[model samples]
Target chain A: MPYMDKRNAARLVNDYADMIMRIGLMYLKQTYDAEDICQEVFIKLMSAELTFEDREHEKAWIIRTTINTCKDRKKLAFYRYWSGEPKEELVSGDDFTGNDLLEEIKKLAKWQRVAIYLYYYEEYSTAEIAMLTGRTKSSVQKDLSRGRKFLKNILESEYGKDYGFEKGGADYAE
Target chain B: MQNREKIKKAFSGVHFSEMEKSLMTDRISEASLFAKERTGKNNMKMKRWQRVAMIVAGVLVLGGTVGAAAGTDMIRSWSNSFSDFKTAGKISQKASELGMNSFPDEIAGFEYSGGNTVHNTGEDEAGNSTGDWDELEAEYKNEDGKSIYISQSPVVEGKDDQQHTDEVVIDGTTVLYDCDEYLFLPPDMEGKTDQKLLDREASDDHFFISYGSDEPETKFFKNASFVIGDIRYLIFSYDEVSEDELISVVRELIQK
Candidate 1:
């Protein structure tokens, strides 16, 4: 739902802006324009008259706007993602710091990454993830199950076996 | 533990912080407050003289004065009324009676009736009570909240710097309402709106606001809207006139 007051709106914005920015940055990976996309998404939320059906709906709207803004930025001429082809032939590879883990996760197929992240980062139920991302509950489950396995393999390949299963089940163990 | 909680622990760094949430909320609040400015961009507004004539006229009624001319003859009296007052005591006395705002007199123009005001006029004073303007045709003004039409001038709001920003102070201490939402753009927008936005009988000073196109096409809409100021204004392409004409119109609106 649209917040009626400034204090509430400010509180919501402050909480979500970083998440939105990271979402935009996750897609385009251009730090210069990441903040612009974040601001634009909020403006879109206001312009489109998006209202929260509930607190959960509001959260989902922000995520959706962030994703749309990322897609919009990709339409710009200068913005093209590296194919992981060859580094020397690329324009500028100033790899933004602190995103190595995120980059690895980006290798996952689009739906898998979206399903994986929304589940792990937002702590949403498979049903709730489906609602947020506009996918089917079963699809979220499939993606989540696959995502877990992919992450397990990533940890094993990056480190070793003990570290993979140890941290892996630990999140589920708790 | 629930499956959701388990997944959450696996990825713990993406929590939305309290401060970030606050900023989004603030933007939404501000955006909604004046969300209509962009839409009103296409609507034509009344002109400078019409608006100035209205506010200067509005002040007259507020000050307990009766009727006053709204022409070049009364310009000084309308803007810097105190400067023409020889007796500071009388000015202070009027202030007490009206409790007029304490804004600098230099910024506020005044119109006194040489000791004759509607407040000072006797109730029995008949017919000629409205000074010389009693014979002129009355027009409606947005004076006093609700719109009222009068042949005689009433106290109306005025903006001396109507056409351009260099003439208006960044803080705009003299403007009747706050001006943060008004993003004055450079010349170039000629017919984005209509020609009716050009001609107006609104105020002594006129302001022309231009709407910038969504630079990157993806941003299809703009959000700033006017809440504090007049809703009527002129919008035209800056190219219609030569450099000389732009400055001339701006100067006339600024009354400099």
Candidate 2:
């Protein structure tokens, strides 16, 4: 399929490189593996005959491919004994805030983190998150609720009452 | 603010550095060549006349900017800079209407720090500009050298607050994760001994981490936000500050 010209293809990669890498990092935690998966996703996009009805369709396709590629990489024998190594470059650059919360999110079960990241950070609907993670809508909703409760406790214990860490009205609908 | 909202803010404020972006570009270029080869082979299947007709169609589309969507998307990335606002000391009428809160100079333990101009406008879902949302910001630092910066303003619903969800409490309270916003140091932090030490520590190769984003949207610190009492507060912290710590700082300030 003559999906996009070379310039357009390059633009797609440039526009989405960070998004793919972020999702990969959220999943893998290991930077190298995430980067590799990011590259593979773009390469797959390059080869796939993807026709988009709109930008959302194109973005969904990329994200879905990235998640699938990351899952495949996780299945590798190397991943079984994978030591979550911290890359030196990322820490040194030392940008972004709320690192402790990010650490806590990383500590979560993979499906939960993926669901939470998509649901909260990416601003995807629970239905959309369910589609992305291959889970039921109710399951995604439950993960968000459970994940929120789990994180609230961790944050409360970690920061203590000096910060007023209380369960916020506790309505977990969205 | 709810814990879910804090989690959302914490995750969204992540910034990817320029170095990391460059690496991603390199990888994309490499992938593009391989993609070109495969697509080129596919092109060979088309008859010459068909190829010619497609080229003409593409040319016509390019004239109207439809075919250059990639190019348009690329430009849109860099052009998404924050808009500047004219400063006013008195509260706007809109603030009164929204019942926004006024913030104290000290939060947790950090003092007021200023760098970037206050922003009063946020983008709507349709990418339209919504007006009359004003902001006030201050930076606070404790004796331990850790600092927090905060921006307070009325909640601008559906205006770039996509991270907002029903995770909000019944009181219409929610927190926003500003992954796209950066925190600049106040004019006073420059040349301070402890601040320099923190900068050195940041670059000392303790742990190298980079987010692979095409957009160069990274700064040297971390930040989070929440809305309470009809006011939205944005907080940025440096030197290994926890999200809980940041929230606590905001809690202390807002409670006052």
Candidate 3:
């Protein structure tokens, strides 16, 4: 029998819907597209007859599916035409509150943004992220490192807050 | 840690609405139906040699999307193991014999968009080998971005064992519901189901959804299969297109 009974799907939705949407928003930077990706992920889950070793495995599948869906949408011709220029109105509502730092993070490459979100926001270990994303552990760590370095430079230039140049900032960088 | 915490909090307030959840459920249900059409391929138990042969042939055919694996083919009629070259040839020849221009350029009021004319020989779900079956798909896009897709193909032989559930009588004609079993709204959502909105007048953006309080709720769009003579017809929509519209299209095709 399939694992995605009505009860199970609802539970999965309740648990991971927010996380999937957040990942989408971080990668796509648009609320409507993020929401669409969130729905597609759940729909993919319903049809994918995957046997997970544990709850952690299932959660990883959800995250990976969300990322893959976003990437596929980006491959489309229309997406290239429209998504090349960030639609400020599309990003401004509830998803983005015009936060300077968050906007800067959106400027990162998709892989870098995903690694940073998983490490800092979701608090997943680098090893866990490697398994989820099918990337080497070193690759995920490298993305995290590069992402932080980029964030540090941007924030220091804008706010004069030497994120790594300050006393406690170096510790946080590690 | 300070920067990390700030990054998390900066984007923490992103919210998904109740309406969004409902719509997601509805779309998921629709996707599940499309997935069910491939259930036959999923259930096939192929041997090692058959798997090897399928991979080689799939690479050569390179349709890319169809028949990549023994059971992953969504074309539905390619049920037989294509391990034999002669059998494959016979199937192709049979498919070549069917006339492709039988379907209308437009279905209902929607205009045809993308279509594929295919003649494929494969096996049925029961492991019975089939000959070349001609298939045509007509995708009609409405002004509202809702697509009305009609796929017409010759009925596969030995389909007598197929069972029908959720049979509904419309205009004295019985049509078999061809969607996922979980798609129908359970009892709890029935009250919330607006009968008026379920009709054809509703906008494409409107969807029928049942919120499951404890468990997951079931949501479905109108989907059904009907047979007119030797041809089998499948009609479905991703939006608020009504079952009546689909059945009417089927009726119109049968009349034609």
Candidate 4:
């Protein structure tokens, strides 16, 4: 059992650290804050009295804790945006875009931009996306549909033909 | 296929580091040591036993302890130890609410006094009702006559508040316990009068102990709390101290 060896715990943190950071960044929208959340999650993992059954259990705990930490942070009063960052900054939406879709989706609202990235780039099922990003399934469905339409319209205007836009849309789908 | 190619191409340029990994081997090794320090080898072996054998053996063993204690007075050894009675109440209720039905024999180091943080007498768990200790904290002067603040960490689901589970004694005049941080204190002999006396007079024979830990993320050595007047005396943890340094400092406090 992983509990038999406590270091398995820290090693667990080191392994999923990146995925956890990215998922948190998608929701939090700040690189530094996402890093802070990642560190806090690991510290919690290290200090926890819990002894897990195995690697799988530890990974699940970290991911779940990451989501819960994000939720907790949302409840807290301060977003404390770092000074000098543009309010309209775009987080990487590489997931849902080729050069064609990427250029188009950047025009969407900030939250909608990520909603599309999560849908197409990360390839999360609607339910998985909802869980990771803390949205209701209906909200996720709506956001994805809205994001898709926005991408569609933007591409249509640029390409002038449905052909280029249709190909980009296929790439953006679940 | 084309979409897959595009996303992968974007992913490649997203600029993550050459995947630098932390050299956490030392941390793991240190954690292994801590785990061992807490649960002795025999305790670990017992934890591995399956249910039926575990229960029967546990009963037989506890029954043996009862017969031994029937003749020995375990209570008389230390009459002055104090434990945190309030924390047990909150944890006990929460466990019941979750149907975990556990009194959580421990929440890490804040076990019974003398057990975890405060080194309180073990009997508090056996006694009466108290308020929630989840938010309880009090200010006290450590051996150096310096101010110190201690309290249980807050509750967030899935996180251990890092509260030393070992009992702490709050008589309201002075706070006493064996918290890991109890070993921490401010720079020497400030705002303290009597504590200096204790450090001076108590040095020769009273109990002297040292506990230290280093944070791997940043190199820092933290010492365990000191005992002055039979309480966890807060002293600076990371600073190096000669054998006589703290003793002399605490001796001055004990004087007043």
lDDT of each: 0.38, 0.48, 0.53, 0.37
Using Cα atoms, each model's DockQ against the true complex is 0.11, 0.10, 0.18, 0.16
Tens-place lDDT per residue, model 3, A1-174, is 234534465567667777887787767765555555665576456434479999888888889888887777666545632344234333334544226677788778777888888888888988888887889999887888778888878888887875553434532433
lDDT of 4 by residue, B94-118 (tens): 4344332223232222132111121
Docking class of 3: incorrect
At residue B30, give the lDDT of candidate 4. Answer: 32
Off by over 4 Å in 1: A1-5, A29-32, A75-100, A161-174, B1-256
Report the C-alpha displacement of residue B179, candidate 3, in angstroms: 19
Query: Cα lDDT of model 4 overall?
Result: 0.37
Supply candidate 2's per-residue lDDT for A167.
39
Candidate 3: segments with Cα more than 4 A from true spot: A80-98, A162-174, B22-111, B115-137, B141-148, B153-230, B234-256
Q: What is the lDDT of residue B181 in candidate 3?
A: 19
> In model 2, where do residues sit more than 4 Å from their true spots?
A2-5, A80-85, A91-97, A161-171, B1-5, B12-16, B30-256
Between prediction 1 and prediction 4, the one with superior DockQ is: 4
- Backbone clash tally (model 1): 53
TM-score of each: 0.41, 0.44, 0.56, 0.44
Better of 1 and 4 by TM-score: 4
What would you estimate as the lDDT of candidate 2?
0.48
